[model samples]
Target: MTYISRAAKILSSRVSADVVILGPTVIGEGTIVEPMVVIGHPVRAKLMKALGSDLGIDEYMDSISSGSQIGSNCIIRSGTVIYEDVVLGDNVETGHNVLIREGTRIGSGTRVGSGVIIDGETIIGSNVSIQSMVYIPRGTVIEDGVFLGPNVVITNDKYPPSRRLDGVRIRRGAVIGANSTLIAGIEIGENAVVAAGSVVTKDVPPNKVVMGVPARPVYDVDVFIRKRAEYEGSKAP
Candidate 1:
């Protein structure tokens, strides 16, 4: 059961909506956004009204863009700015002050916490958990079962603030901890674990444990050999 407050009802007349509204937001049609939520459009910049009344063409345009794709049974909380051409699957939850940029595709059952800036053209797979203050750079791919801890920053530029080209790919089951940095063009193998506060400059092996600046292998040769042998033995007679 969805409930719309009296305030939301009055605000809905000045705005667009589907079922419920708990706070201020310039929403689109067919969207059932939840309470205390602020969806679409970024509170109109100071320089915007100085130029024109065409809020549609203003810097905060996504606050009122059409053709947005929000699936059923999703909970979009307060102060979330979902940009134009963004597509979200069912059962997705977005917390406060999160900026989901245009051309992004989010799979089902993904829970994104507050203050996350998911850049354009990023593909996030199902069952992913992204904590707060994480910046998923443009054109990146986050596959299934991936977990990103708070303050995790993923970059796509070896040159930073810009890349020679566009796009970076993060494979499946890759768990990046808080304050870790991933360099450009490096493929983090499936099920890899990156330690907190580490800086990665090279490719990480599958199911491996890596840490520290220019993150290297933490396990000894004997440990690697023993683990590999045990794995191999389990598969054999």
Candidate 2:
């Protein structure tokens, strides 16, 4: 059942009938929201529950929900849930079953693949490509033009179940390979590359290529680029 709030502003002609848009959510022009998508879902429900508020669910949600903003020309696939207070810039696309929590900001032209879970307070820059099954924890910062391959896991807690959470920062144009696990508090420098299945435990210098369980710099970005060019040139048309 579709539920669009009276205070919501939906300028898009492509929103599916089965979607639920609550609060003052804004869906911009030409955006396509697929079936089962829930935009501007209030996150205050958890807080209200914890506080044992006497207010009804709908009433409390309506009172505190600020709603999300989905920019123009974007595509939000099926089963995606964007919580209230999230902002998606123009042309941002998300694959099926993606979860973007509150306080997350996704810049324009970013493409998030299926099963991606972006926890609250994450900042993702423009043109970022996050492939399938990526797990981005809270406070993670991904700069422009970054590529996160399938099943890449970025953590936040340095010590398991600890109070302190430190997010990993992936600088501009960095490439994190498939199945790579980036430990908390590490920084992948600009244009750096983490080879497939690596477990990064520390900072990677700019333009370097790191690999292995405790990933170490093996070569520079120039070498990796040259090798890629050679491989592409060798392929038959």
TM-score of each: 0.70, 0.94
| Alpha-carbon lDDT of model 2 | 0.93
Error of 1 at 81 (Å): 0.4
lDDT of 1 by residue, 157-223 (tens): 7875663744556678877879888777777778777888888888888777789998997853345
For each of the candidates, give the backbone clash count. 2, 0
User: For model 2, what is the alpha-carbon lDDT of residue 91?
Assistant: 99
Clashing pairs in 1: 40-63, 41-63
> Which ten contiguous residues of candidate 2 have the minimum total lDDT?
44-53
- The lDDT of each candidate is 0.68, 0.93
lDDT of 2 by residue, 96-190 (tens): 99999999999999999999999989999999999999999999999999999999999999899999999999999999999999999999999
